[model samples]
Target: MNKTTWAMVTFSVGLGLSACGEEAGGPTVEQVAKAYEMYMNVNLATELGQRIEVRGWEDFKPGCKSSGPERVKCITGGKVELMGFQGGEQTVPKPVSVPAEFDLEFEKRENTWVPVRAQKK
Candidate 1:
């Protein structure tokens, strides 16, 4: 077979295998949001404690706040900033933001709302 034909065959096989091997109990938006929150809590707590231990002051803070719903905007060290969602009743819109944190960048994967791999921020 020609190179193009062989490449197509390989691509097809890979796609089929990946689809078949998809993990069970696939992650959901709710799960990802919760994981994100847990990660943030732990990481931020550690950072806060570390600064206190090293600098002898708890003045340092992670400037962030919940913008209603499951959304949060965090600005860290005046450089990096992250926006995330943790599915909840407060999510924007009346019914609820099903795909809560739906279109947000730090949320999309392959154009679909997929569970975050980091399991934490």
Candidate 2:
């Protein structure tokens, strides 16, 4: 193979390896976003008198930065459907498209990162 092609392959492999290694230090952005969305739905349900389930949570690309050895800050801006009751209704829920973003902090507990606090942005 040409040297240029070999160098490109080497760089890609190294980048992938480094990303895998970083997983040992903290939870991923996806985890933080899921937890944050769950909490938001709970509050929304109580206040709106309806149930809410966030769909497509895995697709949320929350901006995560290391706050400490066991802490991470996550900011979110993703589209998800809230599937559940719309109000004080008991029937099946109709899915609603929602564009939401949240700022949250997570602390590592055991083998998972749990949301500790949420801040308004």
For all predictions, the C-alpha RMSD in Å is 19.8, 14.9
Q: Give lDDT tens digits, candidate 1, residues 15-107.
A: 221111122222232333333333443444234432111111122122333333333332222111233233322222322211112121122
Look at candidate 1 and tell me the lDDT of residue 98.
17
Q: Each candidate's TM vs. the true structure?
A: 0.23, 0.62
lDDT of each: 0.26, 0.53
Highest lDDT among the candidates is held by which one? 2
- lDDT tens digits by residue: candidate 2, 10-115: 1111222121113354445445545655666554455666656665554555666777777777666666555675565534545566666567666666545566
Name the runs in model 1 displaced over 4 angstroms.
1-24, 49-121
Highest TM-score model number = 2
Off by over 4 Å in 2: 1-25, 28-30, 86-94
